[model samples]
Target: MSSCAKADASSSPALEKAALLGREFSLAWLRAAGVSDPEVAVLFDQVILIPAAQHASARFADPSLPRKIVRTIPWSRARDHHLVLAEAAKQQRLAAEVVAEHFEAAHRFDLARAQWMKAGETSCHAGDYKKALRLISRALAIWPWDEAADDRARVLREMARCATNARLTDEARKAWEELADHARDTGKHDLRADALHQLAILSADPVRAGELLAEASKLATRELGPEEAFRHGLAHVDLLVNRVRVAAAKLAFVAVEEAALKSKNPALQSEMLGWKALIAAMAGEAGDATRFVEEGMQIAITHQLPEQVAFAYKRRANIADYAGQYSLEKHSHNVAIRYCRESQTGEEIVCMGCLSYACFRTGDWKEALDTAREVLGQPDLHPGLRAIAGGVRGMIAAFRGEKASAFRHLDEAIRLQRAEGMVGMEFLTLWALAYWHDCQGEGAKACAIYDEIRTLWRESDDLHDSIPGLLFAGAHYADHGRAVQLADCIDIIGEILRKNDLPEARATLLALGAEQARLEGDHEACDKALREAAALQIKAGLPLEQLWIESRHPRAEDHKGVIALATKLGTKPLLARLKGEDCGDSASGLTPRQCEVLSFLATGLTSKEIGDRMGLSTRTVEMHVSRIFERLNCRTRPEAVALAQARGWIKLP
Candidate 1:
């Protein structure tokens, strides 16, 4: 018989005990000899050492082994080791039952504190804050008097704080409160400081929040040294920045400016300084805003925060756009786009929306559309951000004369903004909707929307604001022969322009004069005023407005002026519109299919019904309509049809 059988045969109690102790020693030797744990355990259990062998295997298979040792063991013995019996149960190995039995025995002898601590760490790593808390609580319960228990509890509380920081919902606020209670109970200075900081952030009362953060920062400095204090101070600065941003969006410029100036931290100071520049610009202090923004840009660049740098550039771009510095605006927007795209944050979406608007202002409608499409395509985009993207897309489509598509995007944007309770965007959306109506030749509807926007602005005490809405409304009144109303609107816009010392005010005045002259049938005055407007439009590189003026006159002087400007600008859309060609056709010329589509549009068919007749998708019909609008010097379906009728290209049925 084997040595094992001989050992079992001598079954005296002392001898059996000796045999069991020997088997245990032999297994240790085997483990040191590089035999796998599962194989060695199996070999020992199969040996004929009777109760000695069994007892030896039981001790060897205890799951209470150190983690380092358990981690290296083979799959079979992992099951036999009672330590990971729950995990072993998941395996389908033949030794699963034996492993489970060993696991049950080992669990009875296992320290709950050790298991809870291990589970807490694993859950924290996996971002399961709730599970981590549960495990830490278990550990605390098992060893309530231990220092290690307090440490584990503190770590779990910190994890909960991090999860709460992700979303500032009521549930997160409650979680933060619970974490603070735990921190205070444990008397861990670092944990207490962290809880205090989080409580400040979650506080709805801004004054109280700031006070709490200040105290937390001081406490952290006293307890955890300067580095921890500075980190906490950074959080305080971020909260202030958020509050300032909210104020800015509400047009509470004074509040934003004050808050920014009050921030003591260098980075926070730089950010607030930038916000001051933005508010100044919005308030029509262009020169001061521009100078301040230049300084802010330098500071942002020095600080090396890509988000701040992008924000500064975007603010500069807005200032430039307002001042009619098209080239400078384009440069600023390009820089903003670069910095925003490089940063891995949600702020990039805001930059993209600004860039899209800049592209639209520069008459790069295709670039604007492409950029807006990219922003809207992001899955994690905020609802407010997506609404802005849609608004930009609507503007691009409107500029391209795709009325249906423009309205579709604008409607979607309005829906999103309303859903988000974004009241600040309401006036802007109304302006866009008004412009869409104007494109479709529904002058009355456009004027009504403009009136509503004016009422909103007046009620909000923003009547003196130099928003683009004033310009659009003024132009619309001028177009419709409301000369007196137009003059009043012009005076309001002119006062704002004069206050800001904007050179473009001259062009707007000249346009208003020309419109009044045309209504009065004074060709000479109209011609002189229009000539001055054209000069300013050319100087400012505003081809869209220049094209509009020339399209109305179409005389030698007007046509020549437009062609020269388009040639100098190298703007394809302007050139095509001036030449009475299809905007969608490449320089190579229109295809036969394009001609057929244009013919159908000239007959006044909507794109949707046309798609059904042609057995094409509505998208394809939209593409053809876009092309037709571009070539025909028309910005709407009715205009295209009218132009076609005037040209005798199609009969009005």
Candidate 2:
């Protein structure tokens, strides 16, 4: 391809040696590889080779030139060039993979194996798992197991590490299996235990993961001290939590705590206590969660455990979330991040994601969006943290009338959470999607997703953290007559509310009751429920939610208050919906019943009097009136009647 390939036979020998040095090489490396003639450097001046980064370096201008040159040389001469290049690379302390390539080209597999193994390890440390796996495979392909048993075992470990980090579960499993067999054969109990633990991490089935963890822990206890086994025990506890087996995870934690106590490890005890708080929070035991956080924080502070202190603060944020203490939740997440930064344990990313959730709950949309964007921008974030960031951004986008962005972010969040086996996290994203659809008046789409969430809630114990948000969504969906199972929402949530005095639970439950009353056409009961719910929400320090609840009635003052609150909070979606900017329907977005209510209101009849005339319940009349206000985008009955009159929907003499 290059003019050098068309060169005479006299120049072919020097070209062949340069080709063996690779397509690119420094003049010094070329000289070390035995093509030291000063004329050889000048030969590359004719554009077959070009200057490279370093002075006196040249790379073939045409990629195919090196292969073409190699083809003209005999394998015997090429082998000599390879040997020289390999020795030269080693003397210069080049990259292991580079030296390995040369040795492999020279057909010295024995020498190549160690260099390839070293290259793989370096790649693994660099987080280049794909390259690491390839290099490790090359080393294993020619491994002299009997002669270098220790190296073989170490390479196997590196292989598994690389594969796991790459999320190549099948390859990781295969490597771990081989490592386990080799460890058993060599009577290396520690390696066998580690293999079992790693295999457990790769397993998708929780039961199998638990079994492997148990065996690994037992093996570790038998060979080493109880301290060595504690890691396996804690991992099993985390597995149980991921599986949503909170009760089982709690019991597992007890065993882990016993091991921690036995080992006299304060750090382990602090970590165990932090996990205990998390499990309690997940199970809706807010009091227990708070107590556990306090205990964990005390131990972590006394022991000077930075990581455990971060853990305790993270769990405290969880407890605050469950208790509807939004301010505390935000504060705790900030504190956790501070400690996480000091520890450099990477937990700060998780705290940042949780902080976004807190900001969203507290109606700080700008802060929520900014914090989530920051979390999403970080590289190599854990899937669960990424999912949290995505969910928050999506939900905020939905509220900001960014329909396309809402779906894009929410869909990815759901996918990531599901793939990570984070069912609890998945429900939050699902609720956000369903609520967005509900707000858009897409009843079929809303109900479909709500049904899926309901089914999951029934099948798993993981929905406790999601229930508070679900309650609000269910009420909104019910108001639009798109609710999947109102009775189930009321029953399950009522039972939970009875069991725990969650600060937000009572208000959300009452909001659900208001929706039920609206559906039943009980206008008086609906107003009463909303009033009580709004009062509770206000008392709980959630003015945004309170205004939202008050807006269900849509009185002139209530509409003004909600619009003001939404404006102040930068809740663009809510403000737009209130202003009818997001409404796709015509000005006559009211039903026949709503028009009838507006006609009665035009006559200056009270709800009770209107109900008497229409032969309906008073609350039914009130419900119709609220719908008319919403559909007409009016803040008062007079506004609704005036709008209907102007639109020629209704007229009076």
On residues 100-214, what C-alpha lDDT tens digit does candidate 2 reach at each position?
9989988999889879988988988888998999999999998766767887888888888888889898989999998888888998988888899888877766578788887
Q: How many residue pairs clash in each candidate?
A: 8, 6
How well does candidate 1 score on lDDT at residue 113? 50
TM-score of each: 0.52, 0.74
lDDT of 1 by residue, 33-102 (tens): 2435554434445443223354433333332222334344455544334344333332423132333333
TM-score of 2: 0.74
What clash pairs does model 2 have?
A: 399-573, 521-620, 522-619, 523-619, 523-620, 524-619
| Residue pairs in candidate 1 whose N, alpha carbon or C atoms collide under 3 angstroms | 63-83, 79-99, 80-99, 82-103, 581-631, 582-631, 583-630, 583-631
